[model samples]
Target: MSLFILWGAVFFTLALVFYSVGIWNDYCHKQLKKWHITMFGLGVLTDTLGTLLMYLHVGYLIFTAHSISGFLGLFLMMSHFCWAFLAIRNNDLQLLNNFHRFSILVWSFWMISYISGLYLGINGLG
Candidate 1:
């Protein structure tokens, strides 16, 4: 793989790790801990970086269906993270609890984007 794909893959893997851990912790542990916030934040940050690297590698042509889904997924994740952060900052755990329903939706879409990107990468290799 090229360096661009390699680095993008690494960052995207980190993003998945962070997101999975955060979402699992939040759902299973049922806590609004700082670590949860940190994990989710890291997920978003890494995802953004990974996307940026991929975008650069792709020469900024983003008119494909996968690109649209990727953009939507990223936006959803960002919105979810921002909502959670604000809810926590405002001391509204109740609101946060209610808002978690959106988490699953965003995560599902994120996974779709990830899988599609992987398919694209492997197809490129082939």
Candidate 2:
């Protein structure tokens, strides 16, 4: 694989790790925290970097299932991050406590895209 593709894979894996740790930690604690939000932000940033690197490697966009799901996953992740911030900023106890549910849902969706990308990459189809 090219350097861009290799670096993209590394960043994507980091996104997975950051996102999973954030969501899992928040769920286990049953509360939203600034650290979890930071993780989420890092996840988004790394995922974006990975996507951009992959795009550079590809030289163009292709509307495959992986690409579409990736776009949706990115949107969900951004939304989740913003909601977590808002929940903390507003000091909404209910939202802060229950935000893990939404986080899990978004994480699940994001995982689907992540897994699909991995499949595509491994099969040399991406």
lDDT of each: 0.82, 0.92
Give each prediction's root-mean-square deviation over alpha carbons: 1.7, 1.1
Can you tell me which runs of candidate 1 are displaced by over 4 Å? none
Model 1, range 1-126, lDDT digits (tens) per residue? 667778988998899999978877787766666677788899999999988888788776667878788889889888878877888789886777766566777888999988988998889831
Q: For residue 11, what is the lDDT in candidate 2?
A: 96
* lDDT against true structure, model 2: 0.92
Question: Candidate 1 overall Cα lDDT vs. reference?
Answer: 0.82
TM-scores, all models, native as reference: 0.90, 0.94
lDDT string for model 2 (3-106, tens) is: 99999999999999999999999998886789998999999999999999999998999888889999999999999999998888888887766677888999
Question: Could you tell me the lDDT of residue 106 within candidate 1?
Answer: 83
